[model samples]
Target: MADYADITYAVAERIATVTLNRPEARNGYTIRMADELGDAMDRADRDEEVRVVVLTGAGRDFSVGADLSQGGFDFDPESGPDAAWQEPAGRCSKRIFTMHKPVIAALRGAAVGGGITITLSCDYRLAAEDARFGFVFTRRGIYPEGASAWFLPRLVGMGTALDWMISGRLVDAAEALSAGLVHRLYPADTVLEEAYALAREIIATTAPVSVAVTRQLLYRMASAPSPFPVHELDSRLIGGLGKSSDAVEGVVSFLQKRPPEFTMRVDRDLPDYLPWLHDSI
Candidate 1:
């Protein structure tokens, strides 16, 4: 595992847990933290032993947005217009978006601005009962980052996303759940454990390669121009089922009334012809 200044990474029982470690600052979002988060996600995705990843914070709160105590963000005007620059939150969220492994976000307390935006790409979001979320970019007189403008509307409806982003209001756990922003809610103390339990369930029941492919397919093909492309892809995938070891095991295990031991690994076994893996579809 790599050493991280603002985060911690650990893998146990085929699950990698990446945590925000800046408790003293209420897990404030920083450039270093974003870089570490992107690195951690890439590390986990490449680790064949890691089946799922759980993202959480060390302190009571997940994150309170960007750290401003040190006079706000550090910007360099000398870099000029030609310099390559990417926002901090996008560094993490974009990495998560491309990952082949599933990521579950365990959020508690306040998740505001960059805090919530960074988690928009997670496959599942499990929050604490007392959690509060806000997309307060407008309130802060800044625009949204982390590609939240794309992910938010897909998770919730366009109406909810517009309302949340425009008003810049604080949304409680109940309202967030109702809006489909979060998958489930639990007590603050148990939310992390619940996330682990879900990860364990996935590890025990699903094939790593199948899960990886399906995750990518849903995210990439769901919003395609039409269902024709999806049908073509689905046909190709289904046509190869007879040769898939994991598919055979899945059926055999059910017939034998036993648990399946999937042998296909994500790193080595994902189909080479996956559309997203190539530049052209």
Candidate 2:
């Protein structure tokens, strides 16, 4: 694994864990951190050995948003060396958005500002009982970034999205879970362990190719014009997989009451339509 200054990366048992490492700053985010995160996520996505990714912070907090020591100047787009501007925070979110494997967020302590937006793009977010969050850009005299304005409404309903962004109030883990922002909540000390357990369920029982293809279809088709596109993709995938070795093994294992050994690899076994290959489309 490549070295990263702001985050730690490790893959074990088909699960990749990306840790935000700036505990002293409460994991305050920075542009460098964003680049490092994007790099780490990309690494996990391309590694065929990896089936799931878990993102969590190192210590007391997930991230308190950007490193604001420079105050307003920190957000000045013109201040950065890159002249052709794009939203720096959004790039990391996009990386998570595009990943083939499921990305799960394990949140403890303060998950506010960029912290919340970043996790919004993840497939599932699990919060510690002590977790607290806010869409605090309005309170900070800015608006939501990291393409959160787009993702927030989709994850939580538009009414809830507007309420949070408009009020910019800090919320507890219970509320976040109630609002559907996170899947479940656990004690802070056990949250990371819980995340791994969830990942194991996926790794142990699910077919890698099927998981990858299903993730793609769900994310892509959610914004689709109609269900027809999803149906088309589903028909293609179901038909293709019906004759695959993994499919046969899956059935026989179920009947025999044994664990399945899915041999199909996501890297080479996926049909062209799954990833929307240029030639196939």
Candidate 3:
């Protein structure tokens, strides 16, 4: 519902779509865009009516990375005090990681550097047939930003992540899919449609709070040394949910062989343990 210069935000049918709106520079990423994206994501996460979010670009490209219109000086971190510096793309990616709503990236064209890194936190990436991707930091004589060193390896495995990040090569849609960078490939025009369809499907069938908790657990437990921690967290979440109104409806609907009308609001109904509260840096 808020206005953004570099992106558009809309919510319909419980889905909030955050679109990168800078098309002129192949939808180049910018500091303003990243701030806007993080703000939009926070809005979506707090809105109980929103169950899913779809991230995409407004024009031909998703993003070719940060706008360097001013010159390469923008990449000079030493020019600014380290404490005052914030990687714009990293802020957005962190927001995605923390959001309760599932986030899906819909890529149509070039997604390189900040473009690709920004999407690493998305639950899934659906790209178009003509999409081109890269992690070109090495080629630019810079290291990866946006905490991509952590996200990239997790999503695509260390070997593949190293190859992609170290090589700094441009990859086509096929290679992206083969390398697990994206989950599905579709025609450019249909990528958004598919993303919307997927969102609707999830909204219709799943309990919102359950989905939120499950997403958190999966992401948090990935680096867990053993299943014991997960088991403990799972027990607390599941045990609490079993007594919920939504759970009752879920069971009743199943017995009656009908669709469930889930009523749990994420803001009001999410378990206390599921939240990972923190102070801002």
TM-score of each candidate? 0.96, 0.92, 0.94
Task: Report the C-alpha lDDT of model 2 over 160-239, residue by residue, as the tens digit.
Answer: 99999999999999988998999999999999999999999999999988887777677777898988878887888777
TM-score of model 3 (CA atoms): 0.94
Any idea what lDDT model 1 has?
A: 0.92
* Candidates sorted by TM-score, best first: 1, 3, 2
Best by lDDT: 1
lDDT of 3 by residue, 1-281 (tens): 35789899999998999999988778888878888999999999998989899999988999999787734334555666366667788999988998889999999989999999999999989999999999999999988998899998888799998888899999999988988889999999999999999999998889998788788787878888999988887888777865799899999999999989998888887777653644252
Local lDDT at 62 for model 1? 97
**Span of 10 residues, lowest total lDDT, candidate 1:** 74-83
Off by over 4 Å in 1: 70-75, 78-83, 279-281
- For each candidate, what is the lDDT? 0.92, 0.86, 0.88
Candidate 3 RMSD to the correct structure: 2.0
Candidate 2 segments whose C-alpha is farther than 4 A from its true place: 70-84, 275-281
Q: Model 2: clashing residue pairs?
A: none
Candidate closer to the true structure by TM-score (higher is better), 1 or 2: 1
Candidates ranked, most accurate by lDDT first: 1, 3, 2
- Greater-lDDT candidate between 1 and 2: 1
